[model samples]
Target chain A: DQQVKQNSPSLSVQEGRISILNCDYTNSMFDYFLWYKKYPAEGPTFLISISSIKDKNEDGRFTVFLNKSAKHLSLHIVPSQPGDSAVYFCAASAINNDMRFGAGTRLTVKP
Target chain B: DVKVTQSSRYLVKRTGEKVFLECVQDMDHENMFWYRQDPGLGLRLIYFSYDVKMKEKGDIPEGYSVSREKKERFSLILESASTNQTSMYLCASSYPGTSGFSSYNEQFFGPGTRLTVL
Candidate 1:
């Protein structure tokens, strides 16, 4: 069974607009959540993260929102740039365990 | 800067062949992981090592084995290469959390190796 899921396979948005990518998890023990971005042929790089105790965390143009009650989380990228196009993966981990990754959503920011 | 390096960027092998994928990290991280990424399947962990000579199986461990003989090196071995094993292999390393960054789960990844089995 997949503990984490990204229902949307892809998302497209205009440059300078806000792009929202959503994720859901079935495991409640997950206390740490993270987002990673991957370009074609390259490995994934850490983008941003939010702890379960907090509802939101922001880093410059990127923000991650976590709703523990709803078992959902979303990654918001404001002023999405053409360079922001890549495969975005949602990952979560429980205390004292390895992390699990979602299927990933390809986000394309058109100019 | 933290750096993780993989031995190869691409490789092609015939079925029933033995294959080895090597990964090295300069970050001196305590944990090292080997994962395979497939289209629509996401990243699936094959194996991981937390200490030298210590290893653990991840979500998919069949037909895969790992060795951590040195602190900076982790090696994944395929006893017999199969078509189903063909995928992009990725290596990642991470250290135990510090203070405020309680989510020290941030892992640095090496450029992946795309392997193909004939």
Candidate 2:
């Protein structure tokens, strides 16, 4: 069974607009969440992370919101640029367990 | 910068052949992981090692074995290559956290090796 899930396979947004990508999880033991972005032919790079204690974390143009009670999280990018187009993966993990990743969501920011 | 280097960027092997994929991390990290990435499957861990000579099975470990003789290098061995094993293999490394929450540590990944078993 998939513990983490990204219901949307892809998302498209216009430049300078806001893009929202959602993820859900079934495991309650997950206390930390992270987002990784990947471009074609490259490895994934860490984007932002949030601890279970916090509901939100932001880095520059990217923001990650976590709702522990609802077992959901969303990644928001404001003023999305064409360079922001890539695959986004949501991962969750406990203190001792390896992070479980969702099937990534492809984000396309149109010029 | 943390650098994780894989032995190969691409490899092709025939069925029943023994294949070895090597990974090296320059970060002096204690944790190393091997994962296979498929189109819709994202990334699935095949094996992981927390310390030299210590290894753990991940979500999918069948037909795979690993070795960590040195702290900087980890090797994944395919006992018998199969067509279904063709996929992109990724290597990642991270340091153990003092807070006992190792998952909080960000993992640095290699460029990945695309293995094709025919």
Candidate 3:
């Protein structure tokens, strides 16, 4: 069974527009959620994260919203640029360990 | 900055060959993990070690083994490599207790190793 799911396999956005990527989880035990960004030929880098206790977390141009009631989370990038185009992954962890990752959403920001 | 170094950037081996992928971290972190990345599958954990000589299987540990004899090093071993095993391997390290800026669990990942089993 997939505990974490990213239904959208790909997303396309125009430059300077906003890109929103979604993720959902089935296990309620997950309390920590993290997002990672990856470019071609490189490993994923940490992007942003939110805890179950918080509803939203923002970092620079990126913001993450978490709705525990819906068991869903989303990453929002305002003024999306071509450089922001890449694959994004949402991961969850319970017991402060054993992270579970989603399949990933490939975002293409057209210039 | 936390530096996690992987031994290989790309490797090619034949089926039934024993493969060893090594990872070293200089951050002195207590937790190390190994994961495989595929096209449709993001990243799946194979194994993790919280301390020396201690290991735990993750979501997908079949056809894989691990060794951690020291605090800064973790190794993933493929007993017999299969073509299906060809994928990008990633190693990550983090401070064991918590994650993120406020007592969090942010992991630092190596560049990655792309392995091809022919």
lDDT string for model 1 (A37-92, tens) is 99997889999999899999999999999999999999999989999999999999
The fnat score for candidate 1 comes to 0.48
Error of 3 at A29 (Å): 0.6
Residue-level lDDT of model 2, residues A1-111, one tens digit each, is 889999899999999999999999999999999999988878888999999999999999999999988999999999899999999999999988998889899999999
Consecutive 10-residue window with the lowest summed lDDT within model 3 chain A: A92-101
lDDT of each: 0.93, 0.93, 0.91
Q: lDDT tens digits, residues B4-39, model 2?
A: 999999999999999999999998999999999887
Q: Candidate 1 has what TM-score?
A: 0.97
| TM-score for candidate 3 | 0.95
Better of 2 and 3 by DockQ: 2
Chain A TM-score, candidate 3?
0.98
TM-score for the B chain of model 3: 0.94
**Where in model 1 is the C-alpha error above 4 Å?**
B98-104
| Candidate maximizing DockQ | 2
